[model samples]
Target chain A: DVKVTQSSRYLVKRTGEKVFLECVQDMDHENMFWYRQDPGLGLRLIYFSYDVKMKEKGDIPEGYSVSREKKERFSLILESASTNQTSMYLCASSTPGETQYFGPGTRLLVL
Target chain B: AQRVTQPEKLLSVFKGAPVELKCNYSYSGSPELFWYVQYSRQRLQLLLRHISRESIKGFTADLNKGETSFHLKKPFAQEEDSAMYYCALSGLGGATNKLIFGTGTLLAVQP
Candidate 1:
């Protein structure tokens, strides 16, 4: 079984703070993604990495960035957290042309 | 551009009753559709994919290219089957394997 683990299940940050959400996958997948799940809006992609040090912006990449220094780990970074940035963040990893395995989401609340 | 739409926000049914969750997509190219399920307090996982044409946990979905829909169905709803269902689409060759997800439908199975 594939395992994807997130760094935090819940996090609260003050406005203008920097926040980091980490994800790790055990299956050695080549693609990693970061998304924010919001009510009624679905899961919107924030950023994705196809290989180490290679990143692409998704539909909703503004205010967020990602890092993939290694194959097994992907990290999402918020340059300056704002209240509107609060949402359930999910990390997923997959091999090309395959099903993606998701990590337990991190619910980030910006106050 | 690819987009997935799951119209229903919530659906309720008796334990023994049939259930259907509708999903539609807008993509210019041939689409690869998928159904994902997330049980309470659990991470999201792939329930089924269109290419495989197989059912998981008694759930099946058929891709209708003309209608641009992929609706999930089950003959009988089990209490354990209650979960959040999300429909997703991947572009040709998986296009870097990025998936666009719809707003999920929360299914409640009543006993």
Candidate 2:
């Protein structure tokens, strides 16, 4: 089965700390995406990478950054964690226009 | 900008009841619509796509070009069918193939 694995299922961090959320896919898909999901606001894309070493900003890229140094790995970075950044973070991988396979989300809480 | 709208925040139904989760989109070009489901404590996964025209787990979706809607329907809801459903749309002319999602609907199947 195709699998998208997230580094953590739940995480807690302090304010002003740098947090890293890692995702790895076994499908070898070229497109990877990071999104934050909140109640009522839905899922908003933070960053997406179509290929290794290439990245693009999404609708809400304010306090988040992403790294895709390898095709199977994509990492979401919170430069400086804040309370408002506490939400469910999901990572997905896809092949071009096909359906995306998502990881078990990481629920982050900043204190 | 392309957008997706899922008007209902929650839809409650009993076993053997018909289910419909509404989804609408705004796009100038031909759009590809998808329905994603996240069961409790599980990864978000694709339930159906308009292009495939295949039903998974007894759920189906039809894309209406005139109405700009892609509503999910299941003739009989099961107790295990409770999940959060998200509607997503992808437009053709984008290089990154980004998806715009709507605020999800929580389907509660009561036994």
- Model 1, C-alpha of A101: deviation from truth (Å): 0.4
Largest TM-score belongs to which candidate? Answer: 1
**lDDT measured at residue B81 in model 2 versus the true structure, 0 to 100:** 95
- Kindly report the root-mean-square deviation of model 2 from the true structure over all alpha carbons: 1.2
What tens-digit string does per-residue lDDT give for candidate 2 at A1-111?
889999999999999999999999999899999999999998999999999999999999999988989999999999999999999999999888777888989999999
Per-prediction TM-score of chain B?
A: 0.96, 0.95
Best by DockQ: 1
Model 2: residues >4 Å from true position, as ranges? B93-95
Q: What is the overall TM-score of model 1 with all chains considered together?
A: 0.97
TM-score of chain A of each: 0.99, 0.98
Model 1, B53: alpha-carbon shift in Å?
Answer: 0.6
Q: Is the docking of candidate 2 incorrect, acceptable, medium or high quality?
A: medium
